[model samples]
Target: MSNEDVDSRRRRFLTITTGLGVVGTGFAVAPFALSMAPSERAKAIGAPVEVDISKIKPGAMRTEEWRGKPVWILNRTPDMLKTLPQMDKRLVDPKSEVDTQQPAYATNETRSIKPEILVLVGLCTHLNCSPLAKLKRGGSEGMEGDWLGGFFCPCHGSKFDLAGRVFKNVPAPTNMVVPPHTYLSDSRILIGVDKNKKSKKSKAKA
Candidate 1:
């Protein structure tokens, strides 16, 4: 054969070999690359969320998704605060003694760092269903007269007070979970993390 023809054949062989090597390397490394990358479930479970509460009006509620769960932020009014104590006798765990449900800083009557601002998991303790806001005094949509602005799960008639405390005789055994949270500022809060003065305890307990 001619030298030129031999050189052309050699070049073609090198090109084909290089392409096969690249393809083989990609197949060998693909599994490791996927393993190193975070799964969707892992990302959903540990992501932290920051929320702005500056524009949340009194008695209004805002919900944000974190770790694939709904975190509710309620701006309580004077009227809502007044009703909390009155419903204590009717609640199951009025004092919030269930230590597993909230951080130490949030183990208060309002289940929050600030009484005026409530942070709670929107899911009902009975079932994982999110509750509907019945934030109005008196009965609405089959709730009784004593319903003084809280959450109600229509799925099973489970009721939670303004502070997410379960009421007596309700299907829910405990109050709504108060997720680990800390105030970033007067008008902002971080969910899924407690970086406050008591963060160590909060992290341990939560």
Candidate 2:
């Protein structure tokens, strides 16, 4: 690697170390080595991540990093959940039949393993831009009717609802992608891990 590249990687390492409170702890090499895969492109798509989500309050959103990209965890209100199905006719891919955006297990009313909590990659499908959270009713006025809540991409005027479903005539062609994930408990979620692995691990223990 070039000197600049080395410096950048070092900086990232320092940042992660500080963020994770890894100081004075014994290092585990296996998981770190496993995370570095055979291809960068594959690694970019999915990286295992464990997150403690007990702090987020109702009607709030929290951002987490996975595969060097931002992942959003939103705590939706009861009213927000009610707005999703009502928005079907107004959204481009309302049914969430678009396979590219999320896994089959997550293709549901809430678009998640658990209702009232939505997990999605925060990048806009228009041109990979990060969309700003606009969680208020009647978004922008021009869209017409009660807007409920959602995200708005600044790059190309793409708009997504609370379910992350892109609006018609927006720059984004589909909803924001939902990375593979599983809920370890009511308060803990493991992103980048799927249900099949959980089954395998369960079988091994049995």
Candidate 3:
């Protein structure tokens, strides 16, 4: 080939190769850039978690994650509710006196906003082990008799009553933590925030 023709072909090849390199780099970096960007779910880590409690059957429980921690929402039966007062004498903080463990709105006998719905962080206070739900009264769960439905930590033999009350003489120091929560509706609850803020917002709008 002539020199001029050869030079023109070389230029064309260089331009094509450069365009291919740019395209290849863009394809390689696209996934990396996406991985670095914060996802919608990640941004909601510290934000409120809303749950629908309507389908949660009585005496059953539902669990969700908030701030990378497991949070439980238990529907207490009338019988389960009665067991709280009975276990008070055996609980370390029966009345939830330790304010830091839960929000002030949940510092009641049931440790909940509603009388029947109990919300608590599922982690044990002693070592952060997740407790297993043992919701059977006087049933075969290692505890012989008078075993009101509650949670049992297999990790270190810690026990929590149905109301999340730490039994006396247990390894756990206090009751399970109650995350700040509020009832958006009869069957919907928002965790990680209290109802006071919602009420305040409503007042401001009025």
Candidate 4:
């Protein structure tokens, strides 16, 4: 082949290869960029949720899902707090008898760090269904009126008061469950393992 012809062919080949190289680089870089960014599941799993309990107001309950279960963080008003103690007679386990229903630290009135802030798992003891937040006092829902506030499950119509106590005559045999947790600061709650319990478990495993 002639030198000029051969030289022309080489130049054309180099140009095509350069273009293909750039295209391949663009494809590879796009995927790498995606890898560097956080996925939605990753963000949800480990993300620290910030909730402003300040605006929950009086007699109002706010519910958010954490770790696949409904985590209700309620701000009980003065009236609601006053009403909590009076509903015992109407409950199936007025004394919070079902010990496993709540964390050890949350066995008191309101079931929380502060009397005003209540946190609980909203599932009913019957068939693992979620309960509805009842903001009123009475109506033979099986709970007392002085009832103040709480949750009612529609699946089996199981009822739980502000303290996670199960009302009498409900399908749920026990009180609503409270997950293992602790207050991170004043308002932040980490709801999975109890720090103390986890240490004990790890020691036993080791």
Error of 3 at 197 (Å): 5.7
Model 3 lDDT per residue over 80-167, tens place = 8988888878888888887575677667899887889999899998999999999889968777488888998889988999988898
Model 3, runs deviating above 4 Å: 1-42, 197-206
Ranking by lDDT: 3, 1, 2, 4
Q: What count of clashes does model 2 give? A: 0
- 1-206: candidate 4 lDDT, tens digit per residue: 99999999989966665555444221222323334555755544433334455567766776655555667777777877787789888887665656664566576766666788777777888898888877667755565555567788888777788777888987899877776766676656666647667778899999
Order of quality (TM-score): 3, 1, 2, 4
Best of the two (3, 4) by lDDT: 3
What local distance difference test score does each model get? Answer: 0.80, 0.77, 0.81, 0.68
Per-residue error (Å), model 3, residue 173: 0.4
Candidate 2 overall lDDT versus native: 0.77
- Per-model TM-score versus the true fold: 0.75, 0.73, 0.75, 0.65
CA displacement after TM-score superposition, residue 28 of candidate 2 (Å) = 14
Worst 10 residues of 3 by lDDT: 24-33
- Model 4, TM vs. native: 0.65
Overall local distance difference test of candidate 1: 0.80
lDDT string, candidate 1, 128-163, tens digits: 899999999987656787668899998898988899
lDDT of 2 by residue, 1-206 (tens): 89999999989976675655442111222235445666754554455766767878989998877766788999998988988888787788776887554687566767877788899999999899999898877737444347678888889899898988888988799888888888888888877888865787899999
The candidate scoring highest on lDDT is 3
Model 3: clashing residue pairs? Answer: none
